[model samples]
Target: MVAPLSAWPWENFGRFKYLLYGPFLAKVVRSRFQEDGPEDSNWCLHILIICALRGLIHQLWSSYSNMLFLKRNRRIVHQGVDFKQIDMEWDWDNFIILQALIASIACYIFPFLENLPLWNTKGFIALLTLHMAVSEPLYYWMHRCFHGNHLFTHYHYLHHSSPVPQPFTAGNATLLEHLVLTGIIGIPILGASLMGYGSISMIYAYVLIFDFLRCLGHCNVEVVPYQIFETIPFLRYLIYTPTYHSLHHQDMRTNFCLFMPLFDSFWKTLNGKSWELHKKISSNLGKSARVPDFVFLAHVVDVSAALHAPFVFRSFAAMPFSTNLLLIPLWPGTLSVVLMMWAWSKTFVYSFYQLRGRLHQTWVVPRCGFQYFLPFASEGINKHIEQAILRADKLGVKVISLAALNKNEALNGGGTLFVNNHPNLKVRVVHGNTLTAAVILNDLPKDVEEVFLTGATSKLGRAIALYLCRRRVRVLMLTTSGERFQKVQKEAPMDCQSNLVQVTKHQAARNCKTWIVGKWITPRQQSWAPRGTHFHQFVVPPILPIRRDCIYSDLAAMRLPDDVQELGCCEYTMERGVVHACHAGGVVHLLEGWTHHEVGAIDVDRIDLVWDSALKHGIRPVSSTKAKTSQ
Candidate 1:
């Protein structure tokens, strides 16, 4: 018997439509058959084909718009224009191939399902309501499971490996992962069908909506209209945006949802960065400005000893009578003095001194010295550094170099904490240790085949030892920990490891011909060195006293250009003849616009580059003899 028209039976009959029509012309035949069938017949095949076409068109449109956004705002976008590289294109191509395969499978299975009436608008709405209710919670838990250690390493890691995702990256996953993801979307629709709430038309609409939202999430460009959320503040919790999903790829610890932020919000997993990123992108909408070339130097005044000094006390006493003083008394005056010191730390660009090549501007951020190097002050000091970085970001500075104690705190993965915490930040933080190591390496005398390096476990100390070993120089490393020494020895090249000798006793260094004193070394310890030994001091405060018997020099000094007589800070007086190597490293990085972090020991080859760039900016290295003669 013929299936009843009221039950919308044409969906079951479509299985034969394929056999009756030619393989290449099946779509045309299906459309003609649907037109000739009863008015209420379920056009299942036609609906599936329409959904596929809609998804394809929407993906192409969204991808084009995303590309335009990235191109126009390349400077603010993470990973910059590297998204257009050939390797990324290869990744996109693989994703498209897999997605096409999945679409083909869906088309094959859809024709066999029971059909509901095609014209039932009420059923379509009910189906969508049911799908949302059942799918979101299930998808949330499934997504969390994907982030678990085992699953993340085996299944979900490929999708997260790319820091900056693009539209095509949405479907880029392992075959098994794609199947599971597909089931998460499909099971709810199948359940709705079993409950007698959906039709072929509802299925088509859902698929189109799902694919569009997925592409939007991975587009890597902020396309949400800022005014909509601003007008209705609650809408932010209701809808998900590209920047929202980008943070998931950035930190991987929060922001897990398909199209709604409801689950993430309820679970307290929504990233705070989402709102900040939205504000940042919204403020600069439609403007494609390049990040200006500027270097930020973060330094602190000598506040550790400021309170007891007569000069500091006098300065505070004079502050209350100054024309700029706000009329706050006693306790407020004390608070005001502290606030004034912080205000003086504001970042300002130095454009007068020109660096050779493409760099010219330098921004200085002078933090209060009391916050650094003291016990229990790290948290406070880090906060100050965060504020400085944020201010530098406002100035469109691309690279920030942490000076002295700042570098010491930011060595290794310390800077990564700041990057992860401030997702809206586009500025790169560099410790500038590499260039500092290069400067010290350049000053070592050629006659010194064997040298003793104190604090060899420190970042700069280890770097110096490695650089010396690479140059075939024998290095005697003095450190407190044997385990650290073994680790460093193992990391060195096998040939170089033999030349590296670890000495636990500080007195053993006295037998060496030369000494490289790291920041950890004190002045009292230097007296133990042999009388005629050459001492190269790398610490900031000049720990070693000038002894008549030893040849002492600070390797951290750089020569200024011939035309420029001296470098001086308006706030404080700097020592004559040379500046600290860390400060000079910031200058070199700024001149070259090198935004990459320079944390470890820099190669010897880079010394020339830094030197040449310094010259371009009109900076040079003064020979020890010349510096002494000039003094």
Candidate 2:
């Protein structure tokens, strides 16, 4: 078993290339940049010109290689059914290089960039290095922020919408985010407020080189290979891994460093785990899917628009429109969250549903109320699942999903994300794979007095109603035109129909009692209810026989749930889960499954200390939601 996160999969071939091109690279760098100082500057004019052309040659080669590979590998090219998987990002990278150079010099260190008095050979080198040193970190931190809660999901989420990212999606973002996001790109001009023309040249060079490298790194085909340089400590930091950055977009957040590794190393946020996760997800998600030309071209148009956005953004000076105009969508009101969630589940990128391996699982953080979901999904839907979980948990409800969701998202350190971000969500299902809907029929907790069903007309949804009918549990389901839930009740047995909950509380008074226990009692000490749940565990072999790949697995005793349901949604293509709340409004007798998502990481004895303190100071679980009766 090899180290998944530690080993670079490309090391074999990359090292071969490195050894083959050894002294040649040394000569190229030394001859072009004049590492020997004054002698190099004397030939600076000739050196830079040749270097620029040589760079152009390499860029062309890299682009052609990637395109050729895409042609050969038609499957990955046709990835998304709607071409969403294809990235069409193409831009005037060369032109931008020229532009950034000027901006860098003019906007920052204008005095020094002016190359005025300190105009020595070493001084030129100093200015360039200084410019790079500052720009890199600034670009990184700003990029990191763009992935933050307030920005990434909406503003930045658009850019990462693609799973197998293309070069065109490199810098694709809305104009506002693009410009504000690139605030660090103009370090020299923006920071030092430079006035010199030379500084602008430096900025141009920096942007051009940076852009070129980023494109190469993102290219589907590997040119030169990274292993040769990566193992060598210093050079390793210069190149960003394609696998690394792609995962940043896929299951992003952990690795936000770009350009170089300085940001990752400094912040200690360098996610070595991504490369392994990428291979894990890429294999599971089927990297062989083909994409359409139009999809690829769309990326091109988007990049073109994004690049032009900077130029024409402020041109609309008609009435000095307030930035507040964009505020409505940014607020992320209920509808926005719902729409995002709906879109997420429909897309194929949600790696949760297709749980091929042990990649889906989560860790419970005590301070936070929810579980952390961090599975390696190419789609960005984990946030949605996290939110759904929190929404369910906050309401003290347990969700039984047959939605083919890789519930592993929560088991994969998924708890931290907002409800909508779980990548387990996809655009839709393959005809009969609506396993999440099956949860609608699960056995309700005798303790739960209410039930809600959201997508009731689907197959599994109707099944849930049938199951609930048999259990004598109260259940309600919501319906719309396409779902066809009423057909379910009509098809249900007369006995099942008798259990349907309608006009809810009106007929509810006859049968059940809603009670919130005012006191905590051990299972042996008190009868919260005469009927309680029975949990039975059937031990099974590890999902991944190989251990390295199993580190991401969520089956350790600590990783497994206190209680679990299997053979239920695992292979069943049921719609509406036994525990599913089908419609926007439905009723369900909720059951809480205390999975590892809720208590896996907790130290029982430690909880005892806190419980003792709470008991003494009147602070505890029942401290807040306690119910009292007139005794």
Candidate 3:
């Protein structure tokens, strides 16, 4: 059964809900244009600020809570946030928008509210007193009532749907629950106003404090120092800890207080183990987190994509990464973060998941994709990669795979520099390009006898050319350097050498229907291919589909095995449960328990073996139809 107030009227609008403030925004702009001085009341602007502030407060707590390195073991929930829960809570700030509109209407109806002073010390004191006297107990009882059989099933269950509670979970309630919450929240402010003790500062302070406590309680990681309760034992009754509220989520009948445990204590509903668990979690604050079995070393693509990092936005990170206009406002802050990372230049854990009972994590080198091209940044990038490898070796990690530009030949010689420098390393270092070549090769049709290959003398290109030629397919290897071309051509058998033909111009592949793009191509170059030519790409940023008749594929990727568990985040632009071929390659190495470091050149002989092993482990390729859409 659905409650009458279960959904918002503008819920379907999605991100367009920001348009709700258009009229109020126009009013402020008009006031500014008309040169309305301090005499003109800007109550609408004040309400907007308060609403924005509340939302920011929630975001700050969420960002801090998700920092895994800060307090790993203190986290109440170990599971990652999945796309389903992310979608459900994407509109977590809906309550703020609703209250903003309500406040605007109130100001219009009760004109006196528009003239409230900016600061009033007495009003602030009265707001706090009223919140304690009326709001707290009222909310405690209201919360208890909602947990009853009828309301729990219809109205409150949605709020508790997320098994792993987060900061936004505080506001991820149904419209019906917010209706009651809005009233519980409004009483203190309305009472203070009605009693001749209300001001703008009072409203701001009360709402901000309310949001702060709400987010504090739901943040899965416990931040309140346990010694605070030990120093003043009775203070525990006045304030609730994250663990206290987490207990209510675990055993819903207990610890029902809103922000203070006094109400729960009075009602005999406080969980007895709350204090004990809090102390236990606090003990782990200074300890080192557990080591991961596998680590995929990655780097940021750009400032826009950086916001899609798991710690930045759970909802955004859960989906495929893309640049959006809404992210423009955040660019300045993101740039600052980039600068800081460049100065520090160290590796940090970005995200993690469990696979077959083993912990796998993605650790990012503090460098962007473009930075690898910079002459000065290359040394720093390599240093960070080496540091991460050494750290993984020290921690006893089984395998660490280099991703994207981190394994670039120009930057680190396909991760050969570190392997040579540390030959005694126990942890296997893998560039994972062999699997990358296999994924691109396996995607081609069995009848692809003659193919045009771009970047033909490169690491993956060479492997691909050799693999195809051995199967009696003619490979047109495009390259500007004859020395590099001949070096690769000679690696093939004498009979297959005839299959590898060196070409220098786009016109050379004009008649080839099978195109394997290992390098970027121009619109004019793409036009050289005949109609119905399917371009199998391994290029970064992928190529544009200029020809309407021709098809273009995305970067190589494979869907993980069905037994892979808790895979809650999309890998870059890859769909859910899908990962770059390089990432899957590392997993295959760990599963096979390969001791040799798979660095430097990609071994052509093992290409088929790696592909078969991936399939044997249930890792499947992205369907051609599905791969096209990712582009």
List ranges where model 1 is wrong by over 4 Å: 1-292, 303-352, 356-366, 410-414, 420-425, 520-524, 562-578, 600-618, 624-631
Report the lDDT of model 1 for residue 370: 52
| Candidate 3 lDDT score at position 560 | 88
* Tens digit of per-residue lDDT, candidate 2, span 25-108: 444466567656332232233224434553454445333433322232322222211122221222212223333334333424
lDDT string, candidate 3, 32-91, tens digits = 877763332398788778888998898888888877756566887777666677778889
TM-score of 3: 0.94
Those runs of model 3 whose alpha carbons end farther than 4 Å from true positions after fitting are 30-41, 286-288, 624-631
**Backbone N/Cα/C clashes per model:** 4, 117, 0
TM-score of each: 0.44, 0.31, 0.94
Give lDDT for model 2. Answer: 0.35
For every candidate, C-alpha RMSD to the true structure in Å:
25.0, 22.9, 2.7
Q: Please tell me which model should have the higher TM-score, number 2 or number 3.
A: 3
Model 1 C-alpha lDDT versus the unseen true structure:
0.59
Ranking by TM-score: 3, 1, 2
Which candidate achieves the best TM-score against the true structure? 3
Q: Which ten-residue region of model 2 has the weakest summed lDDT?
A: 292-301
